[model samples]
Structures are given as structure tokens and as C-alpha cells.
Target: MAGVGVKDLLSADDIDESDLFDVLSKAAAIADGKLPARTRPRMIGLFFEQESTRTRIGFDVAASRLRHHIVDISASPGSRLGKAQGEDLEDHIRTISEYCDLIVARTEHVATVEEIARLTHLPVVNGGNGIGEHPTQALVDLFTIERRLGDVRGLSVALSCDPTARHALSFMKLLALRPPRRFTLCLAPETKLSNVAAAAIDDLRRCGTIIDRVDNVEATLDHDVLSIQTQRASSIISGRIGEMDTAQKIEDEKFTLTAEKVLRNRSKTMIMNPLPRHSETDKSCDSLPNAAYFDQVRLSVPIRMAVLSRMLAGRRWAGRSPSRSQPGWPETSSPISSSLSRSVN
Candidate 1:
């Protein structure tokens, strides 16, 4: 058994820039079918406590591609093995760990996944943890950005969503660790940065990331990358029938990414949505060249395959030397470079 240095991928804070880049590179190779197949079969457990489509399917496909047998364990509140059924989470995790080589868990609370990691000797991958962090999503998002835009450093990235969204927080946390020189992060009006996020923002600033809080969605559109996160309160629901009404009510046109806006800045900006989108992103914009949101979904398999392979193989990343000099921005610079440059100071 190869010992991948890290035991589990519970948070974005668990990985650094070098490891991130290396995984992405490996992902590209995996997508191209260049990587060799697994020598032996492994059993992977998919333990989802919340409703999901993308993350679950992506992991399932990734595991299958790597020749791993997947055992799906759905433990939603009302299900047979759910907490409501009198099953203890720790006991469930321990039992699952004994049968599976790896466990990918999505739960209602961050502490749930944390406890899963604590109790299990087997490696745990956080699929999505309540309002905490979705490290895998962040990895796929970064990979998509780098693939489409060429690089992540020095690009202006606007994360428009409710401040408490876990995916947004995880993305920001990852960026903070390996901040780009002269990078910009634009926050939506409703976003209230958590204390931890605020500290990360401070670190980004010190590392030369220009941070901006904007009221209008249009204000964020002029940047190099636009990432929209759908509001979670409206998205997560308990009952099946009542969810449609709630989802409809939460679709706000004000935050919608319209075709008109995409046309105006299509050449300069890349549009991204961490999916299951409501009215936040217009369907018409899907056909546009700069729309990388769907591509993010397409790339998730390879990215996840790379992640699982590394964790299972115990591969370690060679770290990069710290640099104080400003990194060069990508050749395809944003049109509003002058204004963006001023915002950095």
C-alpha cells in the first residue's frame, strides 16, 4: 500500500498550491486516458446524508473508471440507517470503514464528517459537509478555471452568492493559501464574510490580492472569472413535494446571469456556476464560448479520479519555494486592467 502523505481530505486547508497543481495535471492526463489502470480493485463507500446529483454521480463514475466497486449508503434523516432511525453516526462510520477502503461522505453538519474522519481508520473524503467546506468541488472548480482560462494566478474572480455558502468559502480558503499576485476577489452584496474568511482575506491582501465588495451583479461581470453560487436556504429541502415551490420562490432575477451580459463581456470573461442552478444563471448563456460551468461538471470525473488515485496511492507533492515577487498575469488580460490594478492597492 503506497502511503499518500495526507490521511484525509476534509477541508481545502488540507492541500497546498503544489499539490493542487499536481493533481490538476494528473487529472488532465486521466481525462486523456493516459494514466494506467489500477492494479487491484478497491471498494469505495459513498455515504451521503444529504440529497445530491453531481457530487455523488461524479464520485461514482470516478471510482468506476479506476476499477473500484462502489457501495452506496444513503443515510438521510428519515432513511433506515439514518440517525432518526436510532443508528449512531460514529457506529455507522466505523462499520462502513471496516468494509470499504475509502469513504466519501456528505452530511448535514461539518462536525458529522469530522466525526466520521475521527472514528474511521480508513481515509475519508468529504463529499459536501453542511455549511462547512466542499474541498472536492473547490478542486474541480479550480481545475476548470485553470483549464479554460490558462491559469489561476492574477485573475480577477468574483464569487457571487450568499456569504455562508460552503463551496464559496472553500474556494476562497484555497485561493488564500496560494494567493496570486495582483489577484482580485469581488464579493456579492449579500455576502457576509465569516471571521475565518475575513482572516483569509487579510492574508490574501497581504499576499497581493485586491478584495472588493460589490452591490450590483453587473459590477462583478467585468472581471476575468465570474463564479455564481446559488443560495442554499432555498435549495436544501426535507420533503420532496414542497421543494419545487421553495426553489421557485428563491429564483431571483437580480442575480441571474443573462445572455445580454454574457454577450457584452463574453470575450473577456469566463462564466462559472457551481451547478444545480436556479435563475442565477440564464440557460441561454449555456451555449456561449466563455461559459465554463458545464465544463466544470464534465471535468469533475477526471479531477476526482486523480484525487482518489493520489490518496489511495499515497503520493506526496513536492512543495514550491515561497516567492515575494509579483507573478505575471495571463496573456489574456481583462479589459478593465487599469481599474483592476488600482483596486489591488
Candidate 2:
């Protein structure tokens, strides 16, 4: 199989159908100890502006297994680059690029991640850039789906998640490249998907995938795979965050899934979640035969290790080469006060 032919993992567009298949295959090979691991340990910068559990740990463990060193950094009051210190993001990125072989970053704003990539020549991996994209998780997810159900070409998938969740958007965009047999979205009735989310659905349609939108989770039980998360019920009930009335509770429950609902519907769909879950998925559903999330998280290690090895060895991915090449923003003395910096601010 060919490599993931790109300089960085910035977005889903960085990969296509063939590249995704190769990644899944490579991950499987790595898991079985059949692939060569990176020999020389390089310094990796794992920077995050957002709180995370799995993505942060998964990359750490994967680096250890592949024999790389991670320089962990996060946005906090004590952080030299954080708002508390009022340090410039670009200056911090420039200093780190000199020390690290590559950088993996997760930020509250997609602009921050893009800025980092633009400021350095070091290979950059996008680790969930706000609600914009989370291509790495998207890759792990498709790997999990294929491992569970063989091929995704003809499978039907239902997504019950925050319409703007980074992982969900990336997952749907990746799915568009392959065009599943059916794609259903279970959204809170009052929710409006972002233009990015809607664009992914349109891409699916243009590529011949069947699309369906429903307001309830149970209505999508018949799909072959259900990738779910907490719905936006609070947004529907107007202003209050801490207050939940009977009507809001009722609205929230409609988008949640339970063992009873699956059994009552007699649906054999494989259930998946990019966890750190809330009430959307009941605890009872964890023991059900259809639950695949635990295994999905477990698979994260191997997939990440595979990706790291591929990138470290200077392997080229099979995806199309980017038509445009941007090598950092042009130097200006007043760069911090520039137009680009304000957009992210």
C-alpha cells in the first residue's frame, strides 16, 4: 500500500479513499508486530490548548512504543505561551520548532493550529482543531469500523452527535470519500448544523451516498453502525445552562440510547462513540454485544504508532499532493497586530 502522501495531517482533504485504506491496513500490520518501527527517537511536541484524555494519552503511549520522546505542553495560567503570560503564539511555535522533530497540536481554535503549521517547517499533526477538524480521530474511527464490519463501502451509518463536534465532522467528511450505502444524522430538532457539517453531508450526497436526517436516535437504530455522542438539547431550551425543566429533560432523553431501545428495536447495529461521554449513551448499553467503543479506544494505540512511523521515516502518503505550498507567513515587524492574528483572536 502507498503512504499517506502529505506533509501534514491538517484536514480530511489531506486523505482520500485509497489513503484511508492504506492507513487501516498499516495500523493492523503494526498491531500484529509485522511492521518496522521507527529506530531513532525524535523529540515530539504534544501541545494542547484544550482539555483531552484519550487523544493526549493515546499519542503519548504510541510515541513511547515507537521510541520517540514527547514534550508535553498545554494552555494554562503557568504556561509561558498562554494568555496569562501574554506570550505570542508564533514566537512560541518558532522556538519549539528548533527543538522538536515534529509537532502535534490540539487547540480551541482551528486558526491556532493553522498558524502553527504555517510558522514552522516541522511536520504538524492536527489533534482536533476546535470544531473544525480532527482527522487523526477520524482515521482511528474508520479503522475501527472496518475491523468490526469488514468493508464500509456498502454499510449504513447513523450519527447521533453534536452536529459541530470536531470528530463527528471529520468522520462524516472521511465517510464522504467512500460514500456509504446510507448515512443518517440524528440531531436535536432545534439544532442547526454548521455550514461545515452541512457541506460534508452535501459532499456525501454528491458522491452518491444516501442521506437521512432525523430528530430521534431510536429512529436510526436500523443502521449498520451508530457513531453517537451527546446531542445539543440544552441549546434548544433557551438561555439557562444549570437549569433543566421537564420539557428539556424529555427533549434530551429522546436523543439518548439505551439497551432497552436497541433490544426493543431488535437492531444489530455496531455502536461506536468517541467517548468522554455524557447521558446520551446509557451505561447499560456498554455491556450490550453491539458496543465497540472500548475496542475502538484500544485500537488507537496501534493506529497512532503506524502513523508516526510512516511520518518519521519520510514515507509519502497516497493522497493527492497539495496544489498549493505555503511556507510560513511573510515577516512583518507588526505581525502580532496583523490582520491574520486578529481573525484567530
Candidate 3:
């Protein structure tokens, strides 16, 4: 399969269906230790402007497995940054890309990722951009779903809470590229969905997906997969912090994924979350059979390893002995990740 270049991952929509599947297929082989293990000196530069656990750690671990050097930078208030000193974002990107092979960024502004890609020669992987898109997270999430349910094409999913979640938009984008059997967005009427999210829904509809918007929790819980995302506006904005009640309509105590809902689905259903929760999903669900979010977290390492290997070790992946075992590859799996510095494996 042809490789995804620097510009192919700026947005979820930017990913080609074939290349996306190739990434995913490579991810699965890497996950099972069937693919060539990546080796070092390959570097990935990271720039983050927000707090993250999985996005940061996952990419770091993945890069380590791929044998890459990772450099991290956080654009926080106390960090010494040219941008902090009134430098333009483009200048920062230009200066950093000189020394790095790849750039991974997590910022509230999608334009930051785009600008970095435009200014730098390195591959820029979007971690999360406000309510824009979390492409890597979507990759692992889809991998977990495929691992659990066999095929996503005929499955049903209920995307609940946080209409503005970038990961949610990415997930929807992935679904549209292929599609689930049926999918529903379970969000409050007042919930703000991003333009990307709206476009993803429209794309899914065009792909013959049975997609719906539901307000009723009971109706929303009936799907085969239940994915939860945190409210970006409430988490990122200072005025919205600790205001979960106002930001989300799901009840703090009762609206959670209780054992009741899991049992009601009857058929095995999975629940997923994109970390740093603010009372939308219950903590107890972590131990349940339905919790695939942790599995999604687990797949992040190998998938990222595959991505980094493909990007920096192109000659290695190309010249290495061919493994005919990876069948029907490009249409199957996709994965990616990020860090706060230059660390990438």
C-alpha cells in the first residue's frame, strides 16, 4: 500500500480509506509481535498545550517499542517558548522541525496542527484539537471494537455524551470511512457539535449508515457499543471547570453505565471512554465486561509503533522480508499516538 505522507493526517477526513486500513493492518501485526520490531535513532517531536494521560504515555510507549527517540515540549504558561514570547506559531514549527523527523501535537486549535504541518516538513500527528479530532484515539478505539466484536460493518453503536469530543469526531470519521451497521449520537440538545462532527455524520449517512440523534438515555443504551467522551468546553475553559452538571445532561448518579444497562443489551456490548472523565461515565464500569476502553488503551502502543516505523523507518519496513501473513490488510486496521516532547518509537 502507498504510505500516508505528512499532509494525510491533519484531520480525520484527510486520511484516505485505503491508507487508513493499511495503518490499521500494520498495527495488528505489530500488536501480535508478528511484524519487524522497530529500532532506534528515529525521532518524533511532540508539542502539547493541554493535559493528557493516554495520548502522552501511549505514544511514548509506542515509540519506545519502535526504537525511536522522543522529544517533548509543553506549551503551558510556565514553559519557555518563543510563542510565549510573542513568536508566531509558524516560526516555532519551522524552528522545531529542523531537528525532528516527526511532529506530534495536542492543542485546542486545529489550526495549530494544520499550521505546523504546513510550515514543517515532518509528519504532524494531531492528538486532540479542542473539539476538532483525535485521530490516534479513534484508531485505538476502532481497533478495540474490531478486536472485540469481529466486524464493525454490521454492528450498532451509541456515541454518548460530549458532542464536542475530538475523539468522538475522529471515531465518527473512521466509522464513515467504513461504517458500523448502525450508529447513534446520544447527546443533549444543547450540546455543541463541531463542524467536523456534523460533516462526519453527513458522510456516514451518505455511506448508507443508519445514523440517528437521540436524547433519551434508554433509547441510546440499546446499541452494541457505547462510547463516551468528555466535554471539551467544560474541561478546557476556566469558567466551565467543576460545572459538570451544567455542561452535561447525563445524571451524575443514575445515568451511568450501571449493570442494568449492560444486562439490558443482552448481546455482549462494549463501553469506551477517551480518558480524563468529568462524571459522565461511572467508575464502576471499568471492571465490567463491557469496558473496552482499557483495551483501546492497550492497543495504542503497537499501533503507534507501526505508524512511527512506517514514517521514520520507511526503508526498513520496505526492505525487510515480506510477511505474507498480513492478509486483506489495508481495509482493516488504523492506529496513531502523541507525546509532549520529541519522544517517538
Highest-lDDT candidate: 2
lDDT of each: 0.70, 0.75, 0.65
How well is each residue in 98-145 modelled by candidate 2, as lDDT tens digits? 999878998766567888888888778888776567888888888898
Question: How high is the lDDT of residue 187 in model 2?
Answer: 66
* Model 1 agreement with the true structure over 1-345: per-residue lDDT tens digits: 234345778777777777787788899898777864656888889988787899999999999988888997666445556545467776777777778888899987656777787888887888877766788999898888877776678688877675456677678777775565444444333334455456555667777887666544666767888888554431342232365656655445556677797676544578888787777777888887778888999999999999889877766433222210112111112222222223211
lDDT of 1: 0.70
**Which is superior by TM-score, 2 or 3?**
2
lDDT of 3 by residue, 1-345 (tens): 345233335455555566567778988888777866535567787788777788888888887776677887555565556544566676667777788888778875545666666787676777776555677888788888887886788889888765555677668877876688788776554454544456566677788887676654456556788887544432443235455466555553333566666666563667888776656666766777778777888888877776677666441122211211232211122221111111111
Name the 10 consecutive residues with the lowest summed lDDT in model 3. Answer: 336-345
TM-score to native of every candidate shown: 0.83, 0.84, 0.80
Number of backbone collisions per candidate: 2, 5, 16
Runs in model 2 deviating more than 4 A are 1-6, 75-78, 83-86, 233-251, 316-345
Ranking of candidates on lDDT, top first: 2, 1, 3
10 residues in a row with least lDDT, candidate 2: 336-345
